[model samples]
Each structure stands twice: as C-alpha cells, then as structure tokens.
Target: MREAEEFVDITLLFGEGHVKCHKVIFMILAGRSDYFHRMFLTSMVESALNEVPIEEISASTGVLLVDYLYTGRIKLTTRNAQDLLVASEMLLLGALKQNIEEFLCEQIESSNCISLLNFARM
Candidate 1:
C-alpha cells in the first residue's frame, strides 16, 4: 500500500514535505493511536480536510510513521529516536513511544545523560 499510494484521500503536510495516505488506513490505525482515533473517527475539522498541516512532526518522521502504519515495522536510530518519541507521544502510540524510549535508553551515556534529560524535560 505504501508503494501503491493508491486511493489516497488525505495529505499530511510537513514544512517542505508531504505524505499521501488513505483515510481507511488512518481509520485502521486509529485503534492503535488515540490521536488518529480522534482525528479520523470524530467530527474534528481535520477529518474533513484533504490536507492536514502537521507542524509538530518533521517530514522524515511523518514518512516513517506512515511506513509503520502500513508495515508494522520501523527502524530506530539515535538521529530519529527523540523525534519519534515526541511524535509517538502526540499520536498516543504507546507501543511506538515505548520502542523509541527503549532505543534512547540504550543510547544514553554519562556524557549525554544531562543533555538528554533536559531535552526530555522540554
């Protein structure tokens, strides 16, 4: 489905990037994420829009999210783990959030512990 991009009904827009996906897929993902549940299942303004601006998530993160929604898999790296954690938190994706948390935990070192904590507090 990711490759096909067929029957796409909505566009998630980042600053200079966008991802096209089917509302049906989002409807299915709603069960896993309350953020998606509310947006797709409720009478929210975004539910009716063809293009939804997502200012909080980066374009690369959005693409990874869509990939996960379709494939049930993701690759976590220090470069993307923190951003993924923030996105997962906002999306109410507990499992994904936990996965990112675990990955970040494994990456923590004495030198970066304080900085990581500060970023988390922010």
Candidate 2:
C-alpha cells in the first residue's frame, strides 16, 4: 500500500464543503456503485481533476457516506435513516440503500407504518 499522503489524491466536494480521502477509498466506492465507477472512469472533468462535487447532499450525510465507504459500517436510526436513504439513493449505493430499506422495514409497526410509507414514497 502507498503511504497515506501519497495515496490521498481525491477531494470530494459536498455542497460547498469537502473531504479528503485516499484514492483506494474511491476505488472501493467505484467497485460498489456504478455512479462512482462512471464518475471516476468516464467523467472527463472529475477524472482529470480527481475531484467530485456533490452539491445536493449535506456534509454530515456525506461524512456518513464516506465512512461507510471506508469502514463498511453506518449508524442507522429513525432520526437519520431517512436522510441517509436519500443520500444513498443519490450516490447510487445499492448495498447501503438496501440496508436502509431493510432497517426501515424492520421498524415498521402499527403506529409508524403509515408514516414510514409516506417517507418511503418521498
């Protein structure tokens, strides 16, 4: 493996915010998401600059996304699951999306079923 500084080649800009990560982390994302694969491999500007701008996602959610990308773990709860779902969908993270969906499904019950349905539709 390359040294940390040498491996760190990409800057992900998220809604006027940004994060730095190793190219290896991005390789993991590319393997997982078609969106990221295309972004890194096919998008001329991003491929050349090694930078990606994610304007629609919040920095906190972006952090979560990166954490999941690197660590393969995410903290999902009722408070943040919805936003994470949106982020995962936007990022084309199929595994994370399915995880969130399954979590939400498990949370469904008599009281929150309708609310969960509405949220899912949105």
Per-candidate Cα lDDT values, in order, are 0.87, 0.83
Among the numbered candidates, top lDDT falls to: 1
Candidate 1's C-alpha runs over 4 A off are none
lDDT of 1 by residue, 81-114 (tens): 8888989998899999988888888989999899
List the lowest-lDDT window of 10 residues for candidate 1. 1-10
Candidate 1: Cα lDDT at 55: 82
lDDT of 2 by residue, 1-122 (tens): 22244667777888877777877776788898788898877855776676778888877888778878888999998888988999888889988999999999999999999999899777
RMSD of each candidate relative to the true structure: 1.4, 2.8
What's each prediction's TM-score?
0.91, 0.83
Candidate 2: stretches off by over 4 Å: 1-7
Indicate the TM-score of model 1: 0.91
Error of 2 at 5 (Å): 7.5
